[model samples]
Target: MPHPNFILLYVDNPQQSAKFYAPLLDKQPMESSPGFVMFALDSGMMLGLWSKHTVEPAAPKIPLGGSGELAFAVADAAAVKALYAEWQQRGLQILQQPVSMDFGFTFTAVDPDGHRLRVFAPYDPAL
Candidate 1:
């Protein structure tokens, strides 16, 4: 069984991308280079930032979920709101305000590369 545990995002600038991501991920890159940086996420997933112009043989079509929206799961509604407020203060481009939906309270923000990062919590009717 093949397990996918890594995600790669091609950015125009790797260093800048790492800087933008560090605070959000609450961690720093485990490895870095002039053209690449790798972040070891707490969820046991690895995120790599690579220069779009320098990938070997060039990268095939990038999969960004219809608009580069990356959904990040949160602990709950409060966590979602806290993140929304935090990212809002950081001045990232906010695409949507936090609101209740089929999933739960959630919001969307845009990264430096125009990637839509969504934070969502699972809905539960029970208190």
Candidate 2:
């Protein structure tokens, strides 16, 4: 049976959002246009960033402050930490610092267009 394969995100500025997420995402978008961009994830899922103004007026809006945070599972905690530091240096707001949690180590940051993203690495199984 065919299953869900992609997640579409509406942003005020698709180009800026694409630039901001390129480094954080596993891979840059395979396709990008003036109003949209698509990134292929390692999990076989795809993410689409589309300009809000370009979407049809009939399209449903994603509720503000909804439970739609995007979380990425990384392979290395150090890499995630470095990325968080880099983003902070680039003037992005850091919502949470890298911290050890029950499930793993994670940090949260807001993208250029205000989307919340969490980057994390699983704890060492040998710990």
Candidate 3:
């Protein structure tokens, strides 16, 4: 089976979404157009922003978030807290504050298009 290396998020405007993500991801789009934008992550994965109105197969009209989340794993709880503060300072809509969960120390924020962005430090029994 082929490994998955890409993720696409439907957005109202790919250009606008790119603007919102560029600073947060600290990367520029390797590919960009009116209806699509693509960013290359350090992990070799790719993130794509596709215009909801222009997707070929027609995406469902349901709400944008809550269906899933794009999660970023950090080294420790302190890192999660730092990122949470940074994102908050950048004006992201914070949905959850830093808290310990069964999985880790985490927080949730939303993009302008309502895509959930989760930052977490995986629970480490060794720590």
Candidate 4:
């Protein structure tokens, strides 16, 4: 049986996307070619950034608008807040500031291409 693997996103500019994503991901790409770069996340999931102009004809097109909102389970609310501030300082568009929710503390931000990312940490009842 074939195992499920990486999810690749098409980007008009791979280098710029890589720069924006590297810090958020907390790691640099393990392998990078002219058309692609892949970062291995802590969850063992691989995120790939592929050059839109160079990808194969069969490569799936990323949906326009906010169809996909990637949620990451972070360590704590403080970490989430720090990342939110960092991304904002970098001039990235923030959709929401960190807030307590039923499930956790969360925030949202949009990448260079308007891809939405929701970062969150489990809510602590004591806090």
Q: How does model 3 fare in lDDT? A: 0.94
* Prediction 4 TM-score vs. true: 0.79
* TM per prediction: 0.88, 0.77, 0.96, 0.79
Q: Go through the candidates in order and give each one's C-alpha lDDT.
A: 0.87, 0.82, 0.94, 0.83
CA RMSD, predictions in order: 2.4, 2.7, 1.1, 2.9
Question: After TM-score superposition, what is the CA distance of residue 60 in candidate 1 from its true location, in Å?
Answer: 5.4
Ranking by TM-score: 3, 1, 4, 2
Candidate 2 lDDT, 78-107, residue by residue in tens: 888887887788787888999998889999
Q: How close is candidate 3 to the true structure, as a TM-score?
A: 0.96
In terms of TM-score, the best-performing candidate is: 3
lDDT string, candidate 1, 38-98, tens digits? 9998889999988888988797766542346778998999999999989989998898999
**Lowest summed lDDT over 10 consecutive residues: which window, candidate 3?**
60-69
Cα lDDT for residue 90, model 2? 77
> Which stretch of 10 consecutive residues in model 1 shows the poorest summed lDDT?
60-69
The C-alpha stretches of model 4 lying farther than 4 A from their native spots are 1-3, 58-66, 124-127
Supply candidate 2's per-residue lDDT for 50.
81
Kindly list the per-residue Cα lDDT of model 4 for residues 62-96, writing each as its tens digit. 56533787788889988899888888888878888
How accurate locally is residue 54 in candidate 2, as Cα lDDT from 0 to 100?
84
